[model samples]
Target: MNDHDNNLPAVPEGDEPVPNPGLPPHHWRPTDVDPKAEKRAERQVAAFFGVATVALLGFFVSYFAFQVGDNWDTIAGLGASNLMLGLTLAIAFLCIGIGLIHWARKLMTDQEIVELRHPAASSEEDRSTSVGLVLQGVDDSGIGRRPLVRNSLLGALGLVGLAPIIMLRDLGPLPGDKLLHTIWKPGMRVVRDVVGTPIHVSDLEIGDLVNAEPAAIFELDDEGHHVVEGVELQIAKSKGAVILLRMEPGEITPWKGRENWSVEGIVCFSKICTHVGCPISLNERTKHHLLCPCHQSTFDLADNGKVIFGPAARHLPQLPIEVDDEGYLVAQSDFTEPVGPSFWERDKT
Candidate 1:
């Protein structure tokens, strides 16, 4: 009585505060109590799996239906093949994921259990128990017992793998000798890009850098027939692309064979970078240096486009130029050497 009286003086037993009321009442799911409801859920999950199978089949059909290259058109300019393939595969995976979630929530055992926190280090017994739980989960998944579902899912996944292998065909016909040449031919007129105006030697002044393409690129007959189109046009334009620069004649140190290649201080070189094929136009007029923004590879336009600095391993390819009888700038010939990065097949001659 003495101990109880001393402790109870601060708060009377009749006035003690009430403890918190916890979470809301738990309601049993329809599937938990109704056998018919559970069966309906199982049918819904199976239907989802069936829909996923159809979506995967659609992916395969889309892959073969679309053709590659110029004749290929797109839906609103979005590649039709890519759009269809991506949509179908995404739907297939989504259906499988949704089906699994529905199966777990509606069909699998859903009883709630409380797990107490433990010390950071686990005993050997606890580790073995954890491993056993994982193995039990594997057995419960029914992946081994249901041969039809397992085989069908495996078949769908295997077919998905083929999509990438089929895409390997896009890697190429191998560049071969294609990069070595462009539409640039002997006497082909050099024209201003976009405007398609033929460039005259007199039109350029010292310290000027002009982005130019071959006149043949814009040429069309009276009947609107292009001399080249489709793949051929793309290949030729890629190789033949060039930049024209004009410096004081005294500023240039022409290589022996290229002495007459320039007209009135105007020289031309391949716009493609020797480092990695990035088109370059950043020109330092005062130093006669052209810089590639991609890797900062610099070339001395005054000294045969020799790599003066940065990571460029080779010189930019020079396009020999001469003024034709009509006074329009024309290619003296194709680049004596290949343009862009150095390759194994490059013969230094």
Candidate 2:
């Protein structure tokens, strides 16, 4: 019916004629047409892989060279260990990606192929053909022909995996008996947490709850002694923290042998919830119940910190307390039991 229709393929009487658009002419890249350009592209790809190798080497150097929190090992106010590790690892991955792209675009075959649609399941002969095609693709990638690219890429991959293994050192020397102890010891004064002022049993009223810590955090000997500093101080405070509450002595139902653990009506227990180690300060003062915010695990302070509700497997650990000659509350000794979340190796014995 028209000039466009004249180029259409013929059809049977019942079927409509369909247009046949011939494939466009394939355009060749500069590397395809010129031997010199092809050689330059291959060298460029090799150089990218070489850079990847160098970046990976830098990563290992940075790992051992920079100590965490070292003042001299900071760049732009961020830790050099973190900054260098991130940059080098990113460059190592980026170089490999860029090199692969350059190799595919410049040197690898770019011919148009037609793959007809077929059923999902293939015959045994088709599977064999697929394996042969995979080998053919590997050969076409020039990895066998190019020793430099292959070796450098392999080296980069092998070394990059070592970065994580080196970081295992940060897990620190095995815990040993360190986790079983804290800054709490005999005669350590109980002080308010943030202000670090010594607390007296007479200072608290009935139904009063105060978050407190060890007095070693605030005191200095004749020569300005330091009990704990930096990370050690933080770890000590976290494990040694306590909540001091004043309730009617008649309301308290002390456990066996713990009858003398409290001073007057004032009692102290660990602030860390036995359920997942959440900080619990929420108090039901009238009922003498301590509620953990994380899991709603409730402990009865009146009954030796017994688990009254929720999913906690252990009761809140109580600290032994006695008033010093100065009338200030002090620990009789360290916690008789471990505090915080329970572990498999914890003293079930």
Candidate 3:
């Protein structure tokens, strides 16, 4: 305002605004005119791409160099496997971004081009003009003239693309035999689920139902540590989970050699439903029938946990139990069959 105001001659009171001054003069960069500066910039862009390639290589090396549970491979409490992967992958991505930006800002054309807006349905002459302009812009990008920068960028992109494929190996293997077993064993006390106290046979009266789990999970070693913690404990509780019921021993129709599997009038059966692995606990006390809440499948708990009605194909597995010296109910051993839904390749017979 001040520069224009001082240079202008005084105007009449009711005249129009002063004549407009157009854009300022353009400032040219050394690379825009000097051959030496342009060559230096081309090399600099290539160097950035080269660094990206090295970072990608480091990503692969870090993946194989560190094992997941190794005792010594740690950085700031994170596993070396995780820490190295994050850092190397971050650097790899950052370098590519920086290289593309530098190439666009310095080595590419600095001239400003303008186009006016037109109708959406362009005439043939306008369409031809656009195609020619696109070809001319491609020529200005200097890909043919700059082989080093172009080749380095392509190599960097190709190497970075393989990172995901290499890490796919970490999906690891299946559970194998782990899913077929639980922590229940001979003499493992039947404990109340949340309270973790061993259940005495005398404490449960006739027609009582108790949701129970294995005591091995709550057991402590010499150092006062849990014998089973974390995922192993969770798995044990899920598979070994059962509901204890007290019925008249005279009413139970045990199959073949399972006559002594129960204690007094108390019996235990797996809480997992056989159809789709849902947990079953709802009971019809008078009929001694256990019902699955998910799909209403019912089992006769009084008759060797046999399927009485609904969708379940197999019987609910019964755990053999006996009274210990302290009168607490304990497992004679593990379940004789798998407790959950049928799996593919399972021997149904």
Per-model CA lDDT versus the true structure = 0.81, 0.87, 0.87
Q: What is the lDDT of residue 168 in candidate 1?
A: 79
* True lDDT of residue 239, candidate 1: 67
lDDT of 1 by residue, 1-349 (tens): 6657777544457553444454566768998899899778777777777778888888878877886678775878988888988998898888888877887788666555545566799999999999998887766665566455556556656666776786676677766667666677788899887677999888988889999888764445698856686787666666677899999988889989889988889989999998888999999989889999999999999999999899888899899999889999999888888888777777544
Tens-place lDDT per residue, model 2, 1-349, is: 9545789655657543444455688999999999999889888988888888899889889988987753558889988998999999999999989988999999887787755566799999999999999999999888898787788778878887887887797888788877677678889999999898999878999999999998765435688876668787877887899999999888888978999999889999999998799999999989999999998999999998999899998888899999899999999998988888888778642
True-structure lDDT of candidate 3? 0.87
**lDDT value for candidate 1?**
0.81
List per-candidate RMSD values in Å.
8.4, 6.3, 9.1
Off by over 4 Å in 2: 1-48, 66-70, 73-95, 105-111, 115-151, 162-181, 192-197, 201-210, 218-224, 227-239, 246-260, 276-278, 282-287, 336-338, 341-349
Worst 10 residues of 2 by lDDT: 14-23
Q: Answer with 1 or 2, whichever has the higher lDDT.
A: 2
Clashing pairs in 3: none
User: On a 0 to 100 scale, what is the lDDT of residue 3 in model 1?
Assistant: 52
Among the numbered candidates, top TM-score falls to: 2
lDDT of 3 at 327: 98
